[model samples]
Target chain A: MNINEIRNAARRNAGHVRRTPLLTSPFLDEIAGRQVYVKPECLQHTGSFKYRGAHNAISQLTTEQREFGVIAFSSGNHAQGIALAARQNQTPATIVMPSDAPQLKIDNTRALGAEVVLYDRESGDRDAIGAALAEERQLTLIKPFDNEAVIAGQGTIGLELANQAREEGIRNAQVLVPCGGGGLTAGVALALEHDAPDLTVHPVEPTGFDDVARSLHSDRIEANAQRTGSICDAIITPSPGQLTFPIMRRLCGAGIVVPDEDCLRAMAQAFTRLKLVIEPGGAIALAAALFHRHQIKGDAVIVVVSGGNVDAPVFTDALNRFA
Target chain B: MNINEIRNAARRNAGHVRRTPLLTSPFLDEIAGRQVYVKPECLQHTGSFKYRGAHNAISQLTTEQREFGVIAFSSGNHAQGIALAARQNQTPATIVMPSDAPQLKIDNTRALGAEVVLYDRESGDRDAIGAALAEERQLTLIKPFDNEAVIAGQGTIGLELANQAREEGIRNAQVLVPCGGGGLTAGVALALEHDAPDLTVHPVEPTGFDDVARSLHSDRIEANAQRTGSICDAIITPSPGQLTFPIMRRLCGAGIVVPDEDCLRAMAQAFTRLKLVIEPGGAIALAAALFHRHQIKGDAVIVVVSGGNVDAPVFTDALNRFA
Candidate 1:
């Protein structure tokens, strides 16, 4: 989809989704050696930007589809997002989540009135379980990052960034977005291309799960050998999406990769300097901006903190280890 | 100070300080049994709303006073606020802090270009130390919350709440503010009285250090029996300020007291649900709204999370214990 479709999606989700704050910190600027603006999507509804896509996709369902209900498969954040979105639209939802996923996320998703189906991360096939369940119940399957409506929904954040930048009189900026399947990156790139061409978008990923970065380097989709071991569990998809990769390849800049240690440091910095609690996956973009400052082309850099759904033990460990 | 003074302070601080977002959570709403909007001043410059008062007070200093420099005494957030504000105004700052204050706060204050003199909280008088330093150096003493300019500066947050409420079409609201010396509560109450008379503001304090609450109940200044033991170091003042107490008595609703355990829970909730890091003192207002919902008056409640400058270990303990 194009920017116009994203704008339409924005209109549809205007009051339904949160317009999270774009924050800045002098301490962060000092470390980066340049101006840095943080788009904290971690502060969005359900504590992640996934709510935007989930709300947009669920809200556009036909009456009959709503009656039949919807199904989604996710490790954590997307499940919570879709559960809350479906509940708001009065549509029943079933989420397939890894049994080993953070307990907080699973409890939260279930609390939002969604039926949860658990699967083993190493041995169970979540897609197969979801597909069979959807068929049995006549439920519509909502793919996390591959659907047009969902991409358009995530693109709305790009529109907000452009407007906020214009309001601040920033003529040019480099935006670093955490990437798993390239859906958020591609959507933002397209929106920025249409609304603020001067601002360039770059995808940021964990060092081991650098599928998006490798794909951009080779000019095609790529896959990661392993995904279950990364500290950044949220953005550890096995590969780039079929639809999202092409759009990202066309409109996005070269991608960046950050190690888990840098992500922990970024999370600690966000807590101390920005008074923000950012999960590991959500901090990859900020890590890239801080440690890879030399690669940035513009004076101003915007880092999108994508989600904050980490377990308590993980967050405490990050703070202690980094400190 | 009046609403016009607050408006002027807001204009003065327009570009200097961040206009922190007013966020909402459905989980929080469920707990409060009403719609709750959070004004997270924890995201403010220097990790607290003290920066507004410090900036306004320092900015209004006379040329001679600016040339000589400024002095203040505090254990944490206020010291950093004054240091940053004075540096921004090109004025040197000397801060008298407790010897046992958090190492993080002391380091942050010094990093901002302030000379820190540590006094033993149990054996030394910080006020005398500050007075002697001001006398020797001819430094202007910027009181943390007692001065008119400082109170007016803090009142700017009230103006923002009124405007934000109007934008959201909320005609009436109950505002909960974490109180130390009652400056924030008094200032906000006065501003709301003039701008949005329908909105009632209440002071929330830690149970052991409920000086403002006791003073409000007695209609006079009352001191806490102990001064230095509360976990909420940012707001452990012994008594309500002479100037701030009168204003709170005149305009504010009855004060609320929350236990330290409740504050810990609030901090964890903020981290998990709002993706915001809030200190123990900063979480008291939110704790009041969550645990003391029946005390709130209107259908819409606004909780002002006043600061976020706790040490790493303290924050980790809160998250772990609460989780």
Candidate 2:
């Protein structure tokens, strides 16, 4: 997606996606020894940044596509995003969710007026089921992070962050973003690079699934089918997507890998000190900053907290283990 | 304090206190059949509305008084609020905390550069120790409630809520505020009554310790010395404060009582649906709206979530009980 197109998408969806606040923290700054601003998407609708993508994608659909409805395969924030977006657009939506997924998510998606089809992750094929349903019903398939509209939609967060920071008298600063399939990070990097080329953008990845870091070093896409289930479940993707990696490589500086324990510790700190309920994935970028991942130094920095959809038990366990 | 004085204090402390967002929930609206807006003071600095009163009290201190330092006795959000506000004002602060208070709170107060003096709740004389310290050190005592400056500071939330509702095109809405010593409820009620007299204000009290509610009905302060800690630790005050009860009686329309179990259920629902970390006391008004008192029918109704400084284990247990 072009930078101008992404900016227009951001403008188009401004009313739909929350203009999530950029909050400054003296406590976080005292720890990092720099001024820190956080773009809190954890407080976004559906409790994640995925709402922007889903809302933007649904808005861009043709009348025929809207009439036929939409389908997607996701067991988490993306599912809720699609469900809420479709509900707002008065379109029918079908979501294929793994049976073992958290019941809170399933209930939320269903509550948003979406039809949820459950498939056992151990034995059932979610993608195949979703694809079949879409084809059989002539519904449009809205890919979670791979489509151009989705990328452009996610890029709006970066644009807003840059503008907000500039308005806050931060002419130049480092921006940190957590990476899953690299869609959010790539979109943000592209937007920031085009709008504020002087600003440095850093991608933070979970340690066990640091495929993006490895890919940057090897100059190619790297995949890891195994070794999932990091503490940061929200961003535990097996590989970086083909479209996202190239964009990230062209726009971002370097990727940083942070341990799962650090993410949990950051999560607890955020909850206790900042009063923000952040999921492990959303805390990773702040964790990287807290642990000092890069050799570079700055007077100001921004961390993108991407989501807050953590199961109560899982969140408690993480807090107990780290706090 | 007069309503005009309280309004002036609120204006003076505007930058210091977060004009916390008033969030609308379609899901909550669907469930209650009324428009629900949540004023999330749970996201305030120090995780509570105590910061507002603390800031206001400290700002009014004389130069000599500030030099002698400030002293407060509490086992909850009050300690953190006093410590942070004192630090910001460049004054020394001494806090007397119960031995059984959460370690996180103790650490946070200490980190904010306050001298935390621990006393045994079972054996040690809290009031005597506090008085001795104040007299010996010549420190200014900042009471948690029962003070005009503090009550005025807490009233800022109401001012912001009224402004926020106006921005959202909502006029003459009903608002519910949880009452402990009645500082928050009284301050908010005074502000709302002054700015928008047509608006109705409801104060929610815990079922077992409904001293404020009883006092409002009887036109006199009441006591329940035997009552303590069934749940909602933040609002377990033994009696209503003399400074706040009269204001509540004058401005508040009615008082609503909510059960402990209902508070837990509201906390769980807030986590699952709105993705907010609200303490038991913070969820009381919402609990009242959801279960106990459903007679509040309006085009728009706002619930003030007072704080989010919950102990992790207690939070986990509450979630499990409700979920």
Question: What is the lDDT of every predicted structure here?
Answer: 0.89, 0.81
Q: Where is model 2 chain B poorest over a 10-residue stretch in terms of lDDT?
A: B224-233
Output the number of the DockQ-best candidate: 1
> Could you give candidate 2's per-residue lDDT for residues B1-323 as a string of tens digits?
66777777877787677667766557777766777888888778888899999999998899999999999987778888999999999999999988877776788789888999999866888889999999999999988888888888898887887787777777777788888888888888888887777677888888888888888889888986544565676777778888888788788877888888888888887776566778888899988776754667567788999888877776777768775
- In model 2, what is the error at residue A297, expressed in angstroms? 3.5
Per-model i-RMS in Å? 1.1, 1.9
- Please report how far candidate 1 places residue A90 from its true position, in Å: 0.9
- Candidate 1 per-residue lDDT over residues A220-303, each given as its tens digit: 778999858888878899898988999998888898988888998999999889988888899999999888888887778999
DockQ, in order, for the candidates? 0.82, 0.49
Cα miss at B38, model 1 (Å)? 1.4
Docking class of 2: acceptable
- For residues B1-323, write the lDDT of model 1, one tens digit per residue: 67887888888788888888889888888988899899999888898999988998899889999999999988878899899999999999999999888888899999999999999998998888888899999999988889888898888899888888888877778889999987788889988999889899889988889888889899889999987787888888899998998899998889899888999999988987788999899999999998888888778899999999888898898888886
